[model samples]
Target: MLGSAGRLIRAVVDFALPALCALCGRRLAEDEVAVCMECLTRLAPACAPFCRLCARPGPRPCGWRGGLCSICADHGRQFERHRAYGLFEGDLARAIRLLKYSHRRSLAQPLGVLQARVVRADYILRQAEIVVPVPLHRTRRRDRGYNQSELLAQAVADLTGRSCTPRILRRRRATRTQTKLTQDERLANVRGAFWVGDPGEVSGRSVLLVDDVFTTGATLDACAAALLEAGARSVAAVTVAVAPAPPTGRGRT
Candidate 1:
């Protein structure tokens, strides 16, 4: 069809002229990927000594005995484990904001590929049989025209040779944004907000939940809880970034 041919031509053009860096708008060099080498080096890599349960930076190396953090120890999380590519700060955070809020869906592919690399290196993600992105409410999806998480999930699935099920989970109710809320408030807002479209799709399977950012862990917990309730054997989380815990209080790990 002519439409299909047009699409193919567009794809070729895009491949020929990849967009510039979302942060700096600089043309990437031949040796560079989505981001230039300078920006990539500036984005701090997450080091170890993180919580085995949630991947948040911790005070000391986790022991295999429990491998849990204070938050996980005090309040058990529904998700089995979590991992992220970097801390939510500097250029990484700015890039994510552009992708999520600025309607730059093209950025998802490169970021998702980066996340896939991180997940592959982590043992928890390697064990997952399926990947499911956190769903957006219908209203939000309509406004945004695309789900950033789903885009990331698709890229990750392609890179890892895994299945990306964007619709296995659905947002059952629209809730207020979590950005302005306290930790407990955020949990309350998302509680009972998600539902499984087909429980059998994930029955007895290990799932990797994908999201753009990990702030309070409330959103991931809510999604993981729904998946477990729908018969997923276990759920691990992978995010592009994890925001540093606030200074006054501890963070969920």
Candidate 2:
């Protein structure tokens, strides 16, 4: 029973010194993470009456006739559809920043759960046969020590009971960061950057592409295009958050 004793000792230590909240640095109760319940509740809620194509807030309900946002209709995207847990702002944005740039992997669990919840509630993820995170290039993965999208996809797969094929998609090129780039530049940067590991694996399967943020949709579009090229029956996207596009006058369009 030495192993059991060791487990008990570890449990006791954990109980005595609970992990602190990652955001506020306050002592967390058992099972709490960097985000406390209070702060989590404060996050902006994303619900119905959203565009069917882009998941942006819409004035009309998501009726059967295929709800499409004006922007989405004007400029069709490669992915079939997109959804996110919340608008990127406040603590949500901060958490994403920490997870992506600061290497705080712990945030992935909560964010993934949140994304899965949104997907389930919206009925978007139920049809997905497999989940694939937007793969990072080998160089970037090595530098970061982990792929944040993979972590998020794993959590989503766990919650949804779907298989997470982390290696199904591969990044062939190490591209520059998408941040601070124009939409055209982002598109150019990601072109020819991705490939499929096994085309047959996803053949005739519905794939769910996962990522941390939906910016100009360039990254997700690239990933979705690759998956479709690999013979995926259909491809959709789910992200932790969606940044509001700036006004057309400000170069968003």
Candidate 3:
């Protein structure tokens, strides 16, 4: 068949080129996006009732009643609620790291597609008037040459029929990396680090913030607070993955 011949040729071309599945290194089909079909499905682990505020994954048989996690229960969060697609481990972890650190910019499309699925499932997010990725500082963006979160935001915006508004939120200054900071330290670090660049764009409108991971709630919360301060009606957030609930009594981040 002509179609079969075309697919074979394309697959051959993909093999000869840089266009392969970032996760498995398989030559991608013409219809396939960033990740292959198998890996795309693998990304959508069940997101049961998580913390209404911080978006932490609940334990097995998680008895959450749309309530707060222990960590979130005691603290106030800037965003009303948040959700994630899967736990940040295993294949999901590998894919994100490759996309982020290895300069696999092509992976953004598939990652955005995965994030889009989560948006469709959440009614509140589905109604978001605009989509914004957590912004990278100017210095960081210059170094990386692209913001992965913005790449994901653009894809989801295309799918959701909403505008991607990167200019609305700005990182006023770069802060320390949050890799090993405790919850309190994270809150302190990102505080006063973000603000709305333009008030007219977000006023009285619901905004959906996107990010790659939800380790500490600090970054997303900080971003949401800026939107709210700019007169945005409400702010909600989504992420590709969330860290597993720590084995003991506290957050891992």
TM values, all candidates: 0.85, 0.84, 0.87
Greater TM-score among 2 and 3 belongs to 3
Candidate 1 yields a Cα-based lDDT of 0.83
| Cα-based lDDT for every prediction | 0.83, 0.79, 0.80
For residue 221, model 2's alpha carbon misses the true position, in angstroms, by 1.0
Q: Which stretches of candidate 3 lie over 4 Å from their true place?
A: 1-18, 60-66, 245-253
Tens-place lDDT per residue, model 2, 68-184, is 765566667878889899877788888888888765677888888798887787665678999999999887787666789999999999988999999999989888887767767
C-alpha lDDT (0 to 100) for residue 191 of candidate 1:
94
Candidate 2: list runs displaced more than 4 Å: 1-18, 47-50, 57-71, 248-253
Candidate 3's TM-score reads: 0.87
- Candidate structures ordered by TM-score, highest first: 3, 1, 2
Candidate 3 on 1-253: residue-level lDDT in tens?
A: 1244554675577558766787788877888876889777877564656676666867642555447676576667888778787888888888888767766666777777778888998888887899998999998887766788898889889988899997779998899888767777888989989999889999999999988888768899889888999999999898888996556433533
After TM-score superposition, the amount by which residue 178's alpha carbon in candidate 1 deviates from its true location, in angstroms, is: 0.8
Which residue pairs of candidate 1 clash? none
Once model 2 is optimally superposed onto the true structure by TM-score, how far is the C-alpha of residue 101 displaced, in angstroms?
1.6
